[model samples]
Structure formats: structure tokens, C-alpha cells
Target chain A: MPALIEAKNVTKIFGGGLLDKSRTVALKDFSFQIDSDNPSVTSIVGESGSGKTTLARMLLGLAAPTEGEVLYNGKNLEKLGGSDRRQFLRDVQVIFQDPFEVYNPFYRIDHVLETPIKNFKLADTEKGRRDLMIESLEAVGIRPEEILGRFPHELSGGQRQRIMVARALLLRPKLIIADEPVSMVDASLRATILGSLLRLNREFGISLIYITHDLTTAFQVSEDIMVLYRGSLAEAGDVDQVVRHPEHPYTRLLVGSIPLPDPDLPWEGERAIGRPAGELGVQGDEYCQFHDRCPYAMPMCVQTHPPLFHTHPNRVTSCYLYRESPELPMPQMTSIFKSSNREGPPEETEQLDALDAELEVSQENSSTPTSADD
Target chain B: MVEETLSAEEPTAAELKETLKVEDLHVYFHTAAGAVKAVNGVSFSLKSGERFGLVGESGSGKSTIALSLLRLIKPPGKIEGGHVFLNGTDLVTLTEEQMRRKRLDEIALVAQGAMNSLNPVRRIRDQFILAYKDHDIDVKRSGLEERIGDLLTRVGLNREVANMFPHELSGGMKQRVCIALAISLSPSVIIADEPTSALDVVVQWQVMDTLRSVQEDLGASVILIGHDMGLMAQFVDRLGVMYAGKLVEIATVRDMFGDPLHPYGQMLIASLPSLESRKARLEGIPGITPSLLNPPSGCPFHTRCPKVMDHCSSVTPILQEVRPDHWVACHLYEEA
Candidate 1:
């Protein structure tokens, strides 16, 4: 089956020279495919500095991958001509995280909608343009009457974002790259944005590649999930399966860190392990990017990087926790305190109780303003 | 200290907040778009030593309320109406110099975005020392560095790091330094505006924990301004939802999230992704937050409200106590 979007060994390396190693690696040797034949939403979830945005940028053609290929229908995106690129643009529209960025501010609300129409050449006459604008606005659940003459400042953040979504609908694109689309919209108004995106994917069969640091919102709109950490794939699989039972320690910690909306539920116990920032890829070329932070990290992990092995039928993980290869050793403990299973210390329960009461306020709630805040 | 048991049965949030009543507060800005009614007749009460959250999307008059409390709204912006009473003291009536003395000593603010809140060039210790001096905290210059270090350690940061510039520390640490400075004065009320927005999830937890513990240590009431329901739910005891330039709903976090009444409040809670209910599709409130300049005549949320009525377009709803201790301003609740 021809995938709607496909990336093979895509690496986005931003730096000066080979030995310099001054640049940050945004996406490292990432490969994934989403089939157009069965269009479904895929979520790319990662915390800050996790190359999720970098991957989205490379896939959207805003920037090219440093190492591998980003192909649409098996065609090289970088090689596409201006017209073909236009067609690609028409097919793959984007709903940006910040709605303010999409608007020129100088132009009226109608102008923002009208310009997209003119650029795509979707309408021929003034009446046709008006009709097209109305249809696009209506398609995204926005009334043309209220939004047509309004200025960007005249509308709310949620409404402005709807206008952004409406602009994307102007083209009826097959693949919509929504990079934290709902992050800027208000919580009360966030659902409408998610609903609109869902409608686009379900009703119009538009395949969406949703990028977000928030697992809950990402899971709300997407079916498949890809976990990225420090520019490398951590876990990729069915959204429900991966989210419900996260394989990688990083994913587990991420899910664990998510703050529940309920005020009473505090994640005080079993604190998530912090990222040891200074511990950059120690074992030369073959080591998991998340090895520094993994609570269950084994010594063998330092020498050999785990491949993205197909563990669960629909899921894949790049962690040695599932590695049973004969070549790989039953790794002895790297850190003495690896798991809770081996604990035999006295007064451990008392220590755990004290740790349990400290409100884990930041773990799950500390999300970079996705689509909700400026 | 206005001593009222935090667990008292009859201690209503309004009654508690009434010790500091902001009556018919109106903050306006003369922008090119005409008079931007940034805070229009915005009135909410905060009793001494009770955490009250003023929540709304950006431009919803949340930040304005905080600035208005401190008389910090700069030129082009003016407090056109209303009174703000903190501990029965009318803050609006106080002179600039009078307020300056009372600023950190009484009314303190933790500004939005931790990065911008701290002075980039200044050392964290110096800022603390300066803030301490501003609040008239008695401490000599010789032992100021050690005291600053002790304070940083209290907020969960290494004391030695205080010597470094603001840029060197992580977002969360800088926020803690800001918290440390804000708390250094031991102000009666601390207003933190979007304090955790810039930090990472793990760091956010630590920062919030620090805020919670610090609030506990001071026994001072906090008015948190933010967009995250999850964070506020855990941090604040009471919550207020603002729209355009008016507060739409105010209630306990438990009530707001457990059983929301207002269309906007219900929508806000429903939009969140919680662990327990993996509800297949999230129901986000449709439309956008309205602009303050010439906002909707009746209900500020009417333009985007799903259950909006005809009367909601013409008549503004006052913040009324719909439920016991739950203050909501909506036509739907006006009938109730």
C-alpha cells in the first residue's frame, strides 16, 4: 500500500562541522509510514527538546532531512517543482500551533481566508471566492456571517484558531499537518478544534499527522502514537495499546507524569526519573538516546543500541528492555536501584509514604503552551 | 492575620474573598481599536489566606485584574471604575508611593513567564537582596548572600547557583528564583500569573510543589493566574473563570471539575484529557474567546456558546452565586 507520508532514516542535524559537534540533533535516523489506503490519524508525542516539532517540520517540507528521505506517494519531496510543490501544498495543508502566526494582522479576517483561496486558485470570481470562503468557514464549523468582516483581534483565540482550521479546509487537503493545533485555543474551546480535526479525518478522509507534547490531547484526536525523545524514536504503536501500556520506560514515565484533570489525584508516589542532561550519548554510536534518563537502564544498553523491534504486532520500540537477542547479554544492573521489585530495605513503606504526599504538580501539568497559551 | 479555619463549614469563598472585595472594577485601555475594555466591571472577592484562581484565556482580563490589584496597569491603560480592598484596605485609593511601600509588603505579583520575570543581567542573589530591602526585611549586606542562599535552598535550588545570571539556570529554576524573590518579602498575598507556562512537565511539577509548599510555609493566600485546569485543580482551593473583561464563574476546583454548571466552565473541563475517562472524542467548546473591544452585549461567551439564547445577546449577566459558594455570571444560571 502506498503510504500517504513516508520517511526513511530521516535525520535533521543542525550544526557547523563534523568534529565540531556543536549543533543539536533534532531527529535522528527516524523511519515511519502512514498508509493513505486506510487513512488514520497518527500522533507524534514528546516533551520539550524531543524532536517531535523537528520531525513535523521535515515532513511538512519546511526543512529537509539531513540524512534520509521524506517521500509523499514514494516521490521525493525535495525534488518537486514549483507547480508540483503547489499541488503538494494543496494536498498537504498545515494547521499551525499559534493562530497569530498564520494571520498577517494587517489584513482583515476575510482577507486571511481570501488570500489562501487566491493562492490555491480555488475560486475564479469574487462571488466564487465568497462562496468558497463561506464553504471553507462552514466546513470547519465556523459561520461565515460572524467571521467574514471581523478582524483577527475582533475574534477570540479559539475563533481565530478555527479560522486557521477553516483556512486549511479551503484546499480539502489529504494530509493535514497539525503541529499542536489545539495548544493555542482555550480549554473550553479546545474540544471544537479537536472535533473539527476529527471531522476532517473521519468525514473528509483527511489523514492528519498530529504533533504535540501533550499525550492526552494527542490521544484524543489520534489513533496511532509515535514517542520521540531527544530526536530519536522511543516507542511507536497503536495509540490505545502504547498509551495504556507504554513499553519504553520514557513513555511509562511520560504517561505517569501526566496530571489528571481532577484536583484530588496527585502523582506524588513513584516519582518519574529526571533526564541526566550532562550524560550525552556515552557509548560512541550505539546507545539509546533516552538511556541517560531510563530508570530501568541496563549495562548492555550502554554498548548496543536497540533496534526498533516489532514486539507487539502493531507496536515497535527502540529499547533493550524487550531485547531477547542471543547476542545481547542478560544485562547486569547498571544502577543498583533499578527496580522496585528488588527492594528489601527496612522502613521502605514509610519512605514511600512520605514521597507519595509531595504533590507531583509539574510532571504532567508542565506542558509548553501547546495551542492554548501564547 | 484574618484567621478563619480553612476547613470551616460556613467559610464561603466569597465571604473569605470579601475581605478583599474588588467592586465594579473597570480597567480600560485607549487602543487604536477604540477603548479596549480590558477589565470591565470586573469584581471578585478574595478572603485572607485562601488561594483564589483567576482563570481565562489570554485577553480575557485575567492579567488585567492582577495588574489592577497592584495599580500596575501602565499608561494608555487606566482604572476607569471600581474599588479593590485588600484586608479591608482600599488598594485603589492608595497613592503610588504609599502602594510602593505596600507593594511587596502587602500586594506582590509573580509575573507571567518566569524567564521575563527575572532580570537577565542581575545575579539572583542581588535581586533577592533588593526585593528584601524593598519589603523592608531586616538583613545586613554581609549575611545577605547566605540568607539568599538559604532561601534558594528552601525553594529547591542550589544556593551557589544564585551567583549565575538568569540565562544559566533552567526555566523552572529561574521561576523558583522568581518565587524566592516574591516570597522573600513574605507578602500577605502572592499573585502568580502563568508561572509554570514556560517550564517542562517534570519541572512544572517541582515548581508547583515549591509554590504549594511555600504557600503552606507562609500561610499567605495565593491568586494564581493560568490556563491549565490540571495545574490549578491541584494548586488552588477556589477557581474563577474570566471572559472578555469579566469573571464568568468562580468556584472550588472540586466543584468546577467534578460538576461544572456554566457553559464555558463545563466546556473548559470537558476539553481536558484526563486519565480515568479515556472518552474517545473530546468535546471542546465551539467558537473563540471574544475580543474585549466591543465584546458581546449580554454574555461574553454568547458568540461561541452552544446553548446560547436570544436574551444572552443583549443583557450582561452579573457574577451571581448560583450554588452555595459557587459564583457564576451567566444568563443560564440567572434563572436558577
Candidate 2:
């Protein structure tokens, strides 16, 4: 079976000025395909400004790519406008990262839940729509009465998120772009929301595009995974394979950085090694997108960028080391990926967390720390 | 796995202890609606160089206990009743002046949301300098800058970052700075309230490792408050399971995972999703945690607990040390 959603060499550049006039590359030479045949999930993992969100937006046809193409069922997404676009929207709904921000505090939960049912004409009569609404809520593990007349604030963070999932379920979209759906929720409830995604994928066979920063959750649900770094494909492959034996340096750093709560683990007991730098993106061609920050960057990496190369069967990575440039020595980038003050507009840490939470790839909201702080 | 029960009267003293002991701590926030009992009759002790974990759902009052420890619980939240003792001295009896002198020197806190804990306008180093001044750490100007740099380095950051404002760094770095601040005075106990809960997987990894090594090196007992059970399992020595406003279980990290006595703890462990088991559909805890204001008749967990007996709904169970070290406040384990 062919890929359900394919972004062939899709690239996007957002300039402060008009499209062609400015010189900022938000996404560069991005390429991947999500198979819809068996209803598997594809997780795009990266830190903030990695162009993961930009890619998601583009995939949903919310934003157009600067170069290459995104096709849905072999049909170009950018060209789909009007009722066709509406159908595309109906088939591919997004479960936003922050459920609190997604809804209005003043509006009752019914308003957000009912909008899609009414807009899509999912139900003919009042009783039908009401039953459909309750079923959707029940499917997402929320009771009809619990969500009936409550405001977003009246619900717990996790409850609000379940409501978001229920609202998306009401549409019964084939593909869901859930960006960091569980990041803001409490720890205990996160697994359930994640479980809902798994349940949806298995039972309903809904193809899921789970954007997250957490690798463990990605490991739990995704069949195939793509690791994004600074708007470039760091690595992509099978979930179990890539996660257990990461091919790329970036993926390795990400897996190594996930801190578990148990203290006996070897990974948790190691001393921290924090190297430092500023502003992650590359302005000039000199630095590898990961240069200055990658633990395994070469001097050559700073002067030239690496192209994505086939390594393990299904995996691909863009690093000079993979090319076996024996003549060049690896100069580590100050860090790998850490949740830093780098992405947000907030001067305080609270706002930084809010910003970190935007939309994590698939279901993981991973971060970049100076991997050097090993 | 049954446990041995010990009464509160038996002082935990056989071992040379400079531990902070909290007894029947009840904290209530006078919200607009009513007096919200945030930390209702909670008790725990931190031994020297021991790492303790406070695990709970939202509104379980873990953070409230942390805030109450430092007297940082803001307006509306009053320490209604409880005795908090640090080392041998009771902090509840101390005046504001004494607490000010003792805070950073004896007990430092790395609060949740790293950046908010840091001052945005002031240079990140100034936050350290201010701490030094506040705690009366006597060192010359030249020596102070180096100390600040060293502190940054200790927390795994560049000394150069000391010159940068909080905004210039990333979330992980800012959190490291918070840990750096918590360690500046070399306190006996460092309370990290939800340190890794805010960061991404990568940053969370970096932050957790940084904290683990830092706590080990300093030999200070740590009180880690987190909602992530996976993280709690990996990072803590002992775990406290809180429900509503009460601590229902306290056990070693291994015991908590291996033999969870409380119904809440068992449900939490059973519900957790792991990388190893993809097919395991988590048994979600049946009902929502009860409202703290008007909690259940007896046990806070009885509403959602699967093993609730008839007597449980009427009689409040006092915290009994069911094992040598593990404590539980459940009637099901009454004879354990």
C-alpha cells in the first residue's frame, strides 16, 4: 500500500519579510511518508523551532511548504481548497497541545464539542447528535454527564484533554495530528490519554500523526518515527529499532536524555555534563544545523552540512560522521537537546514550560540539552 | 506483601539523625469559596543524605507541603496545624527573622517552573549573588564571581552563562540554574518541587541526571515532588503516595513499585504506560480524586478504591508503619 500522507522533499522558509524577500529557513529539505494502509502512527520528534510544528501545519494544509510537495491519497494538499479542503479538514482533525488554550474559558464544554458535529453534519436530528456526542465522549473515557455543561476551567487539565480527544472523535477523522496532547496534563493521567491514542489506532484503525518530544511515549505508540533537529531530518526508521538502537547522534542523545524516576538505573546515576551555546538555528551555510551544539560535530560539520544518508535498513541520518569522513575530527556541539529558555517569548520559566508544550511530535515532547552535559 | 505497624510515638532515633520531621501537617488555603484543606494531616521525615519522593495526582497537596516547609505558601493558604522540625529544632516555633536566617543555609528549594523561580530582569548571577548576601556567605567580590561560576559549572553549565540573563538560556539551563541556586548554601535538604515535570523528554533527562549527581555529591537529603511515576521510579529513593490532601502510603522506591500497599499506589502503578509493554491497556483508576473541601466520609481514597470495606467509609485510618520502613494509612492493611 502507498503512503497515506507523503511530503516529498517538502521545505518551508518563513522570512520576517515577504516569502521570497527574506532569508530564514524554518524547514529545509524535509521528506517523509506516513502509511495509512494499516493505520499506524508516525511520530515526528524534535525540540522547539525544529520545524516539527511547521511540518505538521503543512501536513494538515494549514501552512503551505516553500518547496517540494505534500500529497494526501496521491492528491496534492496545497491545491485542495473549497469543499474538497473542507473534507480534508474533516478527515484530518488536530488535537492541539494545550487544551486550556484551545477552548474559551467562558464557553461551556458543549460549545467546543458540538461545533464539529454541527459543522460536519454528522447527525441529522437533535437526539442523533446528542447520542453521537456522548458516544465520542465515552470513547475518550469521559462520561456524557461529566462533560455536559462544564467550562474548560471547570475540568482538570487531563479531563479537558480527554474532551479534546472526544471532540476529535466526534468527527471520526482518519488521521489525527495530536501535537503534545499530554505534556500539560498531570503525570498519572498522561498514560491514559496516550492509551486513548493507542486504542484509537488499534480499534478504530485511525492513522495518527503524533507529534511529541517524549521518546518513551513515541516508543509506545508509533510504528515508524522521524527524529527532527533544527528543521532537518536527523533520523527516521521503525520505532523499536530507532529507539532501541538509534542510528543518528541526535536520536542517541534524545534517548539518553529521557530521565526516568527510578534512581537505580545507570543512565539516571551519571554525572551531568553541560556545554553551552546560544540560538540553535543556522543562519549561514558554515554550521551544520546541529553544529556548535551537537556532541559529535566535526570542524567539517561547521564548514559544511551533512546530507541525509541511508544507514540501517529503514533509517536515515544527516551527519558527516555517518559519511565516514575519517580525515575530520568530531567537535561536539555544546549540547544535544534540552528544554531551555531558547524557544519561548517568556522571560520567566513558567512561560518557557507553556511554550515547550506547544505541539510535541506524535506524542513525545522531547527536548535539547547540551548533550555534552552527559 | 504484608508490613509491620509502628506507632508515631516511637521516635525514629536509633540512627544518628539530622532529619526534618513533619507531623500531622495540615495546611488550608482560604480560597474565595472556602478554606481548602490542601495538605490535610500529612506526615513524613527526611533523613540526612536520603532522597525522598512525594508522588501524587494534581491537588494531592505535594507542592503545598513543599511551600509550607519554606513558609512560602502564599496568602489564603495558612498552616492550620502541624509541627515541622528541621534537625532538632521545630521550625513552626521559629519567628520570621530566624527562618530568614535559616532558609537557604538549612533548606533550599528549587521550585517548579525553573524560569519563574529565576529573576528575569536581574543577571542570572545576581540571583546567586543575592542569595550569598541574603545567607550571609562571607566572601570577597572577586571570590564571589568565581563561586557563582563554579556553582553554574557544578550544575553542569558554562561559567560564562552566569553573565547571561535568564532569558538568554533554555528551559533546561534555567532549571539547572535553579538547582545551582538550591545548592549555593549547601543545605541539608534540597526540595525540588516537580523539577522535571515541566521540561521535554530530553531536557527532563538532563535535569534529572543533573539533580541526581548534584544531590549525591552534596550528600543532602532531597525531597522530590513529581507526578510522573516513571520518573519517580527512576529518580527517588522512597516514595510517598498522596490522595486528596493526605499521604496514603510511604515506602522505598523499589517497595512502592514491587509491592504497592495502598489502593491508590497499586492503581497508579497498574495504570502507568511503559516502553516495554505496548499492548497493556492501563486500568484507569475508576473515579476522580474527591474534592479536598468536602472529601470522603473517612478515607480520601475510598471513593475510587476497589477494596473499600464498610468500616473504611466511617473510620479515618491513621498512618501506621506497616513494614520496617514502609508506612500506609489504609484499613485493609490494619493487621499487616
User: Each candidate's fnat, in order?
Assistant: 0.40, 0.39
Question: DockQ scores for all the models shown?
Answer: 0.25, 0.25
Scored on chain A only, each candidate's TM-score is 0.82, 0.78
**Candidate 1 lDDT over residue span A285-313, tens digit each:** 57777677677767777677777666665
The TM-scores, one per candidate, come to 0.83, 0.85
Prediction 1 global C-alpha lDDT: 0.73
Candidate 1, residues B1-336: lDDT per residue as tens digits? 111111112225433444466777788888776787888776666776778888887778888888999899998999887778888789888988888987877778887788887888898877877777766766585777788888798788888987899999888788888888887778888899888877666677777788878888987888999888887887888898887777778788899989888888886776677655444335544444555666667777887676888888987776777788787777887664
Interface RMSD of each: 12.8, 13.6
Model 2, residue A128: distance off in Å is: 2.5
Segments in model 2 whose C-alpha atoms lie over 4 Å from true places: A1-4, A16-24, A35-37, A73-76, A261-263, A268-305, A311-313, A319-374, B1-13, B136-142
- Candidate 2 lDDT at A320 equals 75
- Report the TM-score measured on chain A for model 1: 0.82
List residue ranges in candidate 1 displaced over 4 A: A81-86, A106-130, A149-155, A268-281, A324-374, B1-24, B30-36, B47-49, B135-140, B277-281, B287-323, B329-336
lDDT agreement with native, every candidate: 0.73, 0.73
Shift of residue A16 alpha carbon in model 2, Å: 4.8
